[model samples]
Target: MIFAIIIGMSLATMIPRVIPAFIVDKLQFREWVNRWLNAIPYAALGALIFPGVTTVKPDEPHIGLIGGIVAIILAYIGLNVILVVIGAIAAVFLLSI
Candidate 1:
């Protein structure tokens, strides 16, 4: 009974994830739809990161915002991603101290 329950739980978890991959591969989206879908990851990443940036120093939120701005400028300038991240971290650290 325990083994059966575990297998059932695995199937339930896997099905939703697996079905999308198969379906999306077989589907052709309109150009606008494709563009919208392509933007989702960046939107989601910003949503996830924005909150943390704001909360990095609750007493002085600007430190985080400045850090985020530094990161954005570095990225816009086409610095390597690692350098962008390091630059942001350095900005925050220097500002905090």
Candidate 2:
């Protein structure tokens, strides 16, 4: 059982990296797929952020998440990244406390 668990974890860790390297060379996704791939990170961020934003109380919610949304918007508009990150962190810390 221990061996199986270890093998399962190893496969879980390896497959994500291995699948891309193996498949990228052997297969071609269509242009539509390429476009969809560009949105995957945003989808992942949504998956992570949605639960946090919706689950917690207004008083003790994930303050960092709220600040991140603002920083992301500002960065999307081409603001300086360093300042945006600093501002986000500061906002979250102050608001949460």
Best by TM-score: 1
- Over 1-97, each residue of candidate 1 has an lDDT whose tens digit, in order, gives 9999999999999999899788988898999999999999999998988778878889888888899899999999999999999999999989877
Give the alpha carbon lDDT tens digit for every residue of 22-71 in model 2: 77888788999988999999999888877666343466555646786878
Worst 10 residues of 2 by lDDT: 53-62
- Candidate 2: give its CA RMSD in angstroms: 3.9
Model 1 TM-score, 2 decimals: 0.63
Every model's TM-score: 0.63, 0.59
Off by over 4 Å in 1: 1-19, 25-32
